[model samples]
Target: MSGAPAGRAVAWLPVARPLTLVPAPPPEAAAAALGTVWPALRRALAGDAPLAVLPAGAGPADAARAVLRPDRPLEPGTDLVVVTSGSTGGGKGVLLSAAALRASAAATLGRLGGPGSWLLALPTSAVGGLQVLVRSALADREPAVLDRGEPLAAALARLPAGDRRYTALVPTQLRRYLADEPDALASFDGIVVGGAATDPALLARARAAGVRLHTSYGMSETAGGCVYDGVPLDGVGVRVAEGVELTGPVLAHGYRLDPAATGEAFADGWFRTRDAGSLAADGTLTVHGRLDDVVISGGVNVAPQAVEAALREHPSVADAVVTGRPDPEWGQRVVAGVVPAPGAVPELAELRPWVAARLGAAAAPRELHLLDSVPTLHTGKPDRRAVARLHGGDQ
Candidate 1:
C-alpha cells in the first residue's frame, strides 16, 4: 500500500482481477498508478472479470472475492465507460482509454494554471466529478470531498482555510452559495460554473459579492470542461459549425463500445457539441443554449434562454427558467417558471410586460408559474423536460 496520506489510499490497492476497494488518491499519483494498474485491469476484466470497484464504504476484501470469477471471452471494444449527462434524453455510456484520460488531465492542468487540491462537491460518478479526482491525482494533491448530503454552509466549513483550492459547481450551486454563504464563496481562488445556462442575475450577484467565478462550457466528450469563462483553455480549441465544434488536448478518444456514436459526435478530430454559441468581437464566447432549445411560437423562433435572461434582470425575480409548453395556436408557447425574491411575489402579467420590453413581445412568456424551487437534475442543471411535463399544456 502507498503510504502517502490517509486519504491517498487508492495507490495501495492490490492488482487483482476482482473489484478493488482502493482509496481515492491525488490525481497525478493516481494517473501514474493507473498506468501500472490499467494493463492488469484490462487483462483481468477479460477473463472471469475478478474485479469490481466497490462503492464508497464497502469492505475491500469481501468486495473483491464476491466479484471474482473465472475467465470469459473479452467483450470487444469494451473499456472504461462513463455515463453522459441525460439533460436531453436518457444517459448514454461513453468509453475512454487510459491514454485519453491522461491527455485530458494534462491538457486541463495546462490550461487551468495547473491543478491544486480540489474540493469535490459533485459526485465522482459524474464526468465533472470524475475529472476533479483525475486533475487532483495529476497535480499530486489529495482532493477534499465535501459531503453531498450536508448543507452548503456545513460543507464549505469543512474545507481547509488557506490552501489554493478549486471546485466545480453547476449554476444552481453557485446561486445557492451566493444566497446562503456569501463569505464561503471567497475561499476558492477560482470557481467553475456550468452544466446549464447561468442566469445573468446570478453571475452579477456572484461578481458583486467578490467571488471569482468562471462560466465553463464543455461536456463528457470534451473530457470535462475545456472552455473556461467563454475562452478555450490552453490546448483547447473551439469552432462554430452546426453547433459548437471543440478540439484539442481535452477531447475524448471515443465512446465505449459504440463506434457509431463516436463517429457522429466527432468529426475531423473535433467534438461537435450540440450547444449553440457565438464568439463576440472581443473574443469572448457566449453560449446561447442547446441548438434544440429553440421553440417555434406562432411561426417565430423563440430562444428560451433569451427570455430567461430578460426575466432574470428584473429585481423581483430571484431565479427564472423559460421553457415551451404545447399550444394549439402556436405549436409551442413560451412559459416562465419563476422564483420570486423573498416576500415579494410578482404577478405573471406584470412580469410578461417586463420581459417584452427587454426581449421584444415575441419573447415574452404567455404564462408564468410561481415555483418555490425549480426542479433540477443531480448535476444542478434545470430539468427542462420535467418542467415541460409539469406545465407544458393547459396554459
Candidate 2:
C-alpha cells in the first residue's frame, strides 16, 4: 500500500503515531478556523503528522474515524487521507501522498498560467475544497473562504486585485451566482467547475456574462481535478476504453484500509474511473456519464446525461435529472425529476414531446415529477437513488 514515488525508499512511520482527523468547522466558523487548520495542513503536506479531514457534519466525522483508525500506522509516503462517498454514495478513504498533492497543485497552477489568490467556495471535506487549500498553501497566499457570511460582491472585492483570483464551484452554486450576481462571478480570472457535469447551456451563459469558466474533470482519487477544460493537466495522462483511466504523478496512492477496493481500482499504474468517456483525436476528453448510468430502455441504449441536457434547455425546465426504473413493457423506463423555471408550470405532455423531438421517443422520460428543487448530495451532484425514490411515491 506504499505510495512512495518510484525509486524512493518506503520509510514506514511508527505504529504509535496516529494521523489526526480534523472535522471541518461549520461554514460560519470556517474562515476563522483556517488559521488553525492551515498550520496543521502545512505540516501534513510537509510529511509531518499526516492527517485526514472529516466533513463538517457529525455523521461524517464518526463514519470517517471508524474507517480511518487514527491509532493505526499509515503506509509509507501517505500524507493525507480524504474520505469520499464520490458519486456512488459509499464512503471510502482516498490515500494521497504529499508528492502527489503537490504535483496536482503545481500542474494546475501551470495550466492556469501561474499561482495566485484563490477563493474557497467549496467545502473542505471534499477533495476539490482541499485542493483549494493545497494550491493556496503552495502559492504562498491565504485563501478567502466564501463561508464568511458576506455577499458575493463583497467577497470578490476583498480578493487581492493584483493577483489572478480563482475559485472552484459545483454547477448548482454557479447557477445561483449566475442568476443573482453575474458581475461578482466575472471578477475571478478563472473559475473551475467540477464534481458533476456542467450543462453546456450554463457554460454558454456564464461565458457570455464574462465569466471565465473552466469545466474540470477528475475526483478525489486524482487529488482533485487532473483535467480542466477536457484537457489533462501537465504530466497527467488520460485514456478511455470502456471507462476513463488516469495515470500520472497526481494519482492517489490507493484507498486506506481497503486493499481489495484499492487493488481493483488502482492497477498497472492507472486508476480506473467509473466514468464512461471518449478521447477525441485532438486529445479532448468527453465524459458521457457514469458507466452504470446508461439505461437500456425499450432495447435502446439511452444516456441520461443527453436527456438531462436536452431537458435543461427547455423554456419551462430550470433543472432536471434523469434516471431509469423498472417497467413491465420496456424492462427499464426513463424517468425525470424536474425543477421548473421561474413562474413556469411544466407539464408531462409538453416536456415529453420536447425530449422526444430533440432526442427520441425512447429517450424521453416516461414519467415526470415536478419539484421546487432536485435532491443533491453533499458534493452538489443529483442524488439519483433519492430521485428514484421520490418518483416511487416516497416524497
Candidate 3:
C-alpha cells in the first residue's frame, strides 16, 4: 500500500472482488439493446457489482468469459473493466473506477464547451465508444446509437437538434465520412478522432470541408483520450522520459487481475505510455509514434508512422501502412501496404522515390502491396500485424 494524502486513508492495491461481464450485442442489435444496458450501466457506475463490457469480436459469452475471467476478483473501487488490445495488440482488462470514468467524461465535455447529445458511431466495446455513452448518461440524454452500415446523415439527424451535438470516431471512420458525407460530419459541433493517430493530410481535408475535429491521444488507461488536439485535458498531465507518461485523476486504477503488468505500466500516480513523443515549451505534445514501432533498415532507424504519413501525402495513395520485414541483407526492410485513391494504381517505383524525398531512402518502402482496402480492427484502427502479412512479412 502507498501512503495517502493528509486526512485520507491509504487505498490498498489489489483488493479482491468479482465483476459481471456484459458481452456487447452485435452491431445490428446494439440500438435495441442500448435501452436495456443503460440501466445496468448506471448501476455499475454507482458501485453495484462492477461490469466488464466485452467487444463484439469477443465471440460468445463463454469465449469472452474465458478471456476476461469474470470469476476472478478485481480491485476495490473498480466500476468498469475495459478489455483492450491497445497499441501492443495483447488483450488486458483495464480497471476503471467510477470516479475516473466520470472525471474523463466531465473533462471531455468541459473541453468541448459543455455537455450535449452524442452520436455513438464506434463500437461500444472500446473506450472511445464507451465514453460516448458515459458522457450521454451524465448529461441525462440518450445518445443516438449508429447501427452498422448506418449513414452518417441519418445518424446525426437521429439526435435532438437543440443541444450541442458531438460524436467520436476513429480515423478510418472519419476518412470515410469525409469522403462520402462530409456535410453530415460538418454538422457536429465537435468530433473526437482516436484509437490511432489521424493522418495530417486527412485532418487538413476535414478542416477544409468545415469539420470541427479534435485529435485525441490516450488509451483505456486514461479512460479514453485525456489529450485533445495536442493539449492535455483540465487535470491531465503529459511528460516524456523514456516515453510519454500521463498523470491525471481520469486514469484507471490498474489492470484487473494482472498485478505484474499493472505494476510495470502504472507507478507513482503516473501511467507510462509506451509511445515516443516530445512536449513543446508551450506544453503541447507531439507524438513521434510508438517506441516499439521503429524499423531499422541498413543501420538507419525508420519510424513506420512517419513513412505512412509521407505515403498518405502522395496524391495517388488513399491510405497506407508501413511494416518491417526480415531481410537477409538489410536485416529488416520497410514494407508498405497501400490503398490507392479512386481510379489510381500507384506503383512501387513511383512510391519509392516519393517517400524517399519526404523521409529518406532507408525509410522508403522496399516492397509495396496494393490492397483494395487496409485491414482494420473492429475499432477502426489499421491492424498493423495483418498489414505486415500483406507482403508476407512477419510482424
Candidate 4:
C-alpha cells in the first residue's frame, strides 16, 4: 500500500513519497496499476479487509489503514465496490471487477474516438468521475481539475485551445452553463450529460449554441456510462425485456458482501437496471424513467417521465423532475419539481394544461414546485429522493 496526495486543480500530477504499506502507483504510468490495486480495493470495500484511502482534505501522510469488519462474506468474483447515492433507500455498495471497469473504459474510449486530456469538473469518488479519471489515465494524460465553486467561464478559460478536450456534466450543470455562458459550453470537443433526465429544450439550446452534447445512460454496476448519445458503445448491449437490462463485457461481477443484491442485479449475465427504457429500431436506448418512479393514482400507472418531458417543453422550464406522493384518496399523486429558465418564472396553472395535452390528464402533475435550483447527486443526476422528500409531504 502506498500514499500520495490527490492531484490538484489544473494538472493532477502525483505528489508525496510512495509508501511500501500502500504504494502510490500512477494508473497512467502503469496500465496494470488498476489491476494491481483491484484486489485491495475489493477487500477494503467488502469489509473483510482494511486499506487506507485518502479522504478529502487529508494529506498523504495522514493516510491510515482501517479494518472493516464484514457483515457477510463477499462473493468470489467481486473486485471493486461503489456506493450508490442513497436517494430512494439506504445506499448500497455495488460490486464491480477490474475487468468490467477496464472493458467499459475500452468501450467508451473506442466510441468517443479514444481519449485525450479530460477536464475533471466532477468529483472522482463517483462512478462518472472515476470514469473520467480512468479514461485520462488510460490515455496517459493528466486531467485538468476545475476549481471548486468556480464559475463555468473561469473553468473553461483554464484549458488551452486543443482539438480534443472532453468533459462530463449533469443536466443541471449543462443548463446553468448554457444559461450563464453559452460560449463556454462550446470549448470542449464533447460534453456528456447524464445521471438524470435532461430536458429536450436544454439539449436544443446547447446544440444551437454549438455545444456537442451527448446524453449518457448507465450506472455504477456498468462502470459508469456505457451508452453515449442514445447509442450503446461498441461491445455494450441493451435489452429492455422486463426492465432495461444491459449485457456486455462492461457489466460488473456483483454486489460486495450482498449475495441477494448481486443475484438481483445479475440475471443471465446481464445487469438488470431498475430503470425502465426502450431500445429504438436503430439501437438507440431511450430511457423513460425508473421502474419504481411510476405513481399509481386511482389504480392508473402515471409515468412521471411523461409529465416531466411535457413540462420541459415549456420555454420557462429549464429542468423538471416528477415524482409520486402518497395520497389517501388516489393512493398516490404526481408532483413536479421544476427549475425555471434564467429571468423566467414558472406558473403551474399555465403549465398544467400544456402537460395534460401532451401526457394525458392522469400523467399531468397535480402539484408543481418551482425550485431555485434542482438538487443533484454527486454523479450529476437529479436527487429525486430530495425532491420527493421536499414536496411529497405537502401532497
How big is the positional error of residue 258 in model 1, measured in Å on the Cα after superposition?
3.4
Model 4's number of clashes is 5
Indicate the worst ten consecutive residues by lDDT in candidate 1.
65-74
Listed per model in order, the count of residue pairs whose N, CA or C atoms clash below 3 Å is: 20, 0, 0, 5
Residue 223 local lDDT, model 4: 86
lDDT of 4 by residue, 247-283 (tens): 8988877754566877887988889988888887898
TM-score of 2: 0.92
The lDDT of model 2 is: 0.86
What local lDDT does model 2 show for residue 170?
A: 91
lDDT of predicted model 1: 0.66
lDDT at residue 122 of model 2 (Cα atoms) = 82
TM-score of each: 0.77, 0.92, 0.92, 0.78
Give the least accurate 10-residue stretch of model 3, judged by summed lDDT.
58-67
Which residue pairs in candidate 3 have backbone atoms (N, alpha carbon, C) closer than 3 angstroms, thus clashing? none
Which residue ranges in model 1 land beyond 4 Å of their true spot? 1-79, 148-157, 281-283, 392-395
Off by over 4 Å in 2: 1-16, 393-395
Q: Each candidate's lDDT (Cα)?
A: 0.66, 0.86, 0.85, 0.69
